[model samples]
Target: MLRLYESSGRKISARIALGWEPSEVFECNLLEEDRCPVSIQGNEINAAFGAYEIKSYYLRK
Candidate 1:
């Protein structure tokens, strides 16, 4: 699980390195009740967070 938080109202780029490749990746919605598929490249995950937004991702191997 990866959680990202931004206090300021600014867009930010995030890169997370996973030691091992994951078979699947899911992006959790604000409520964390819904999930959607996310693309993964190499051994890392790249994402952009909007202003004053919080994002969470779940990786499954």
Candidate 2:
């Protein structure tokens, strides 16, 4: 899991992509302090891997 924060103090939304897949996915929940909301976009980081491609996405803030 990754933690994101709004250091610029700006309220914004974005789609974050990762290059690997995890057991669990993010759903952009704002329950913790100093932590931004993010969601898992996908697990297709590269096309080199046949079907085991690992990737993720999350909202920055």
Candidate 3:
């Protein structure tokens, strides 16, 4: 299983989906580090995780 969350955490998006419900989100463990690969706009940190493939749309403030 995998966990997914919006920028602010809401019901609009799925906080936790299947390991690869849409075949996009997946849980990966590197050595002793676990990553979910969450995509955040304008953030380069996520780029390294391939989060750039997924786009999070801000519906409201």
Index of the highest-lDDT prediction: 1
Candidate 3 colliding pairs: none
lDDT at 13 for candidate 2?
46
Clashing pairs in 1: none
Angstrom error at residue 59, model 1: 0.9
lDDT of 3 by residue, 1-61 (tens): 3222344433343332222224233344423245445443332113222332333322111
TM-score of candidate 2 to 2 decimals = 0.39
In order, the Cα lDDT scores of the candidates are: 0.86, 0.38, 0.31
Per lDDT, what order, best first?
A: 1, 2, 3
Per-residue lDDT tens digits for candidate 1, residues 1-54, read: 778788889998888889999999999976676889988997889889899888
Task: Give per-residue lDDT, candidate 3, residue 10.
Answer: 33
Q: In terms of TM-score, which candidate is stronger, 1 or 2?
A: 1
Model 1 vs. true fold: TM: 0.78
Each candidate: RMSD? 1.7, 12.7, 14.4
Per-candidate TM-score against the hidden true structure: 0.78, 0.39, 0.17
